[model samples]
Target: MDIRKATIHDIAEKLKITASTVSRALNDNPRISDATKKKVQKVAKQLNYQPNHIASALRSGKSRLIGVVVPTANRNFFSSVIRGIEEIANSLDYKVIISQSYDDYDKEVQTVEALLNARVDGIIASVGKTTENVDHFKKILRKGIPLVLFDRVTNELDVSQVVIDDYYGGFQATEHLINEGCRRIVHFSNSQNINIYKERKRGYEDALIKHGIPVDPNLIVFSKLQLEDGRESMQQILDSKIPFDAVFSSSDYSIMGAMQVLKEKGFKLPEDVKLVGFGDEPFTSFTEPTLTSVNQKSIPMGNFTAETFFEILNHKDQSNNIPRKTILKPELIIRDSSINKEKPKDQTNLEVIEK
Candidate 1:
């Protein structure tokens, strides 16, 4: 009636092999041949072998775990990034723990503490939208735990970050609209405190100015850039009787909402108003008039973020040599929503620009 968990030693005894050999095989060590590793693993599984992570942590002084914090996992962009991170993490025999902040600053702070309490080797995070005070992230640095930020990054903390060139993205989106004969374009943006949004807004303005179009403060609507926010902003623009022929939103969700309102108002897309959005969310392509958007390169962002974390963790002495900021180029996916001129229905639509 007694039951106990099987150990590496038990597997070794069952296979008539040394415990060290069994351990190396279990770890998929290069020294262990594939045939030996397969046999050892099969036997270990048959014996219901379970690794003692606590003992391993105690001996190695590492949990062999990584923490990832994101605003939410519902979005394709965030989930894709997490997948990319797992690809690298799994290869290194490390586990990833994901925490959701739901865009709350207090919750983000709590998650950092919780991850630290769990003794994670390092943390990879995308700053929450409402997180203006980054003291919680700074605390991780004080403890010497590697922290890498991606996507929603902050300049307040001096840490490694992976992000797309948002300024270039905004510029490209705005310039594309202008080239399509869109003047008096309305813009949907979020808080200016976040560097990404700020840079995007800057790019939008500069692009307009470069085309001899004066930047109109009245045309820029600032909000949380959610779907509801997009609806409200579009309504506001309509109510103000602002003459506009295009809309460029920083978020795909918001632009989708704006598109909904525009349709409800009996406006014909492209013919009446050209539209462009950011993030290049998958849903963009399936909409009535497929949306043109900025692709953030989520997969590469996640890979680079994890790589940066390992760099900080494994090369603490060479920290100064590591680049503080890594920027990925953004791609513009041209689609029906942003095109005013007539074209073939089967035109391919991907444009990669240099930084």
Candidate 2:
């Protein structure tokens, strides 16, 4: 019963059966009766039988598997990002196991834990929208599993990260509104759990401060990052007599909702109310008035995240822990939404100095 010497032959001899029968039962072959399969598996496990996975994988030098985690696979931004990841992953002869966090902190922790149990060669992840903990990646780091983060990331973890210039993206978005004659610009802010949204909010606030425009405390509204939140918030904005002229939304989905309602309420885009959104999502441009938003090169971000993960996996012998990071700039894609006669480079740089 010693684990070291335990073998299929030993198992078969103990059960007075053929080695082929024992092997098939252990492998859970349908040809093996359920009772025999259960009995053989029990005895093998009881004897502490361990499959030679290392020997098998090392012989071929191929596990051919990777893991990718995102906040939500259904969201447009993440979907585009994953498509980019898959393109690289497939080219590198790797299969990716994908999971969604549903924006729940606890669920995200569990999903990562499960992926680790699967022993994926590498991991590429965008943290859940509400996840604040970095402890989940501790096991992966400790085990020397190659890890690369994209989009939402951990400031404390110090791992490889690929992200866009979120702060600057926000600044440009807000600045566009001001230039288009929006006197009262409203910002839809997100929580600090994710650095992307938090940085964006900072940029939005900075634009107001630089413009010498007194920051209206009520103008910044914190909402869940969703289309419904955008619609509800916009409805509230319409309900109020705040005399708002434009909106700078953190997400394209929310921007879409706000625009839809504004149009319904007899508001004119650009002429009366200018709108600009972030992420430059596909749907943004397809709307009646193409959305003016920041393009983060989502396709490249995904491919880069996967490529970085593989690099870490292959270069494991070179470094125990690699502090790899990639930063991508966001470009302001001006469309019909915000109508400005002349657009200057760094147009938002010089905010009107307050008296």
The CA lDDT of each predicted structure is 0.89, 0.80
Could you give me the TM-score of model 1 versus the true structure?
0.86
- Against the hidden reference, what TM-scores do the models get? 0.86, 0.78
Model 1, which residues run further than 4 Å from truth? 1-52, 316-323, 343-355
User: For candidate 2, what is the lDDT?
Assistant: 0.80
User: After superposing candidate 2, which stretches have Cα over 4 Å from the reference?
Assistant: 1-62, 318-320, 340-355
Instruction: Give the alpha carbon lDDT tens digit for every residue of 49-98 in model 2.
Output: 76554443565555576878887887777888899999998987777889
Write one digit per residue (lDDT tens) for candidate 1, span 1-355.
1115888888888889999999899878999999999999898778878888767776777999999999999999999999989988998988999999999999999999999887899899999989889999999988878889998898788888888899988999999999888889999999997888998999899999999999999999999899999999999999999899999999999999999999999999989999999999999989989999999988888888888788788885635645478888788888999886575433334443322
